[model samples]
Target: MNAKPRISILFVCLGNICRSPLAEGVFRSVVTEHGRAADFMIGSAGTGAWHVGNPPDPRSIDIARRFGVDISHQRARQVEAADFNRYDLLLGMDRNNVQTLRQRAAGGTLGKIHLFLDYANDRVIDIPDPYYGGEDGFASVYQMIREASEALLSKFD
Candidate 1:
């Protein structure tokens, strides 16, 4: 019997307060629900350093808690250069995030960076940032991330 290799994933966003943290938590929930938590490495990061060392936005925490997942403990960190080669996949929440990752990725690691929603069943799209919006936006983004999270886990599992 052989142990399966873990799939390492890093979810990235602008400030890491809203979208990426939710994505990380959602994916964790999806993997745990499917009993595949031990088969993967999961994390989230921000493209900018403004939110580094800060907890996820309160709205994000509330929305995840509403869905039975707690994201309050996740801290924001800036995406490091080492991250480009550290994870098997670096998923970006939107076009700008993806573009930034691509730009920072070394030539050999380019293929591992992608738009997070590419795993969703529907058309490829960016998960909207909810920082400037109301709670309703957070809820909508949660649903979207959850869908894509489930799809992503299935693809790797």
Candidate 2:
């Protein structure tokens, strides 16, 4: 049997209540489906501390539950300086998140930070924020992450 390389990924957003958690959950689900779940370390965090220690947004949990993905156990937290040394890739939900991460990155962290959609082969688009939108908005964001995560997985194969 061939051993797969384990890659650590950190998904980041503004508050971590919506986008980041959803991206983490969706990306995890995709990797599991591809039988590479064991080959990746996935986590989520926020740029700010507003929602630190809180669970993902209720709306996000509801939307994910509808699609059979569970993000209920995930909690919101701010990205720490130590994360730069821990994760192999730091994925941002949008341009702002990427900028925030870049501003705080130390050492070689800047090179690991990237917009999540940068991996998407066909639809290169940012995952829209669903915090103020409806269920459909969450679903759309999920699809974007799903596609992007698949492309990312391909890169490691």
Candidate 3:
């Protein structure tokens, strides 16, 4: 019998320590809840190199934890050329990240990069970064990510 293929996804933002990590954690939680975790390979990265080795922002971690998801283990990483070929989908948190990814992508790789909220049914197109905002900002981001994650998972069905 032929083995099943896994769908690979990469979430991206300005810095891996914020929105992208939250997206990764939320999406992972959704897939696992649906019992489809093994059917997909998930990861996250950022467009900038500043936080490449740091953990997700403490605010992001706390917000995820409140939602029953743990993102503390995720370390920040900058988007790499190899990632274009590795993931079937490269989800950007905002238009700027998508534009940056497009610039870095080789000819055919551009097709794999897209805005994460494009999958969401809501009118919101961008997930604002809460890195320098208050706790409420993190909570708001959590809701947006959770909604988008659910909508994105529906595409796989």
- Sorted on TM-score, highest at the top, how do the candidates line up? 1, 3, 2
Model 2: CA > 4 A from native: 1-5, 122-124
Error of 1 at 56 (Å): 0.4
RMSD in angstroms, candidate 2?
Answer: 2.1
How close is every model to the real structure, measured as TM-score? 0.95, 0.91, 0.95
lDDT winner between 2 and 3, please give it.
3
Q: Is candidate 2 or candidate 3 better by TM-score?
A: 3
Per-residue C-alpha lDDT of model 3 across residues 34-150, encoded as one tens digit per residue: 988888889999999999899999999999999899999999999999999999999999999999999999999888988999855545488999988899999998999999899
Residue range 1-157, candidate 2, lDDT tens digits = 2375478999999999998998899888889998888888899999999999999988889878887899999999999999998999998888899989999999577899988887545444577888898888888887777778788888888
On lDDT, the stronger of 1 and 2 is 1
Per-residue error for 103 in candidate 3, Å, reads: 0.4
Kindly list the per-residue Cα lDDT of model 1 for residues 101-153, writing each as its tens digit: 98888999999998999745555789999999999999999999998988888
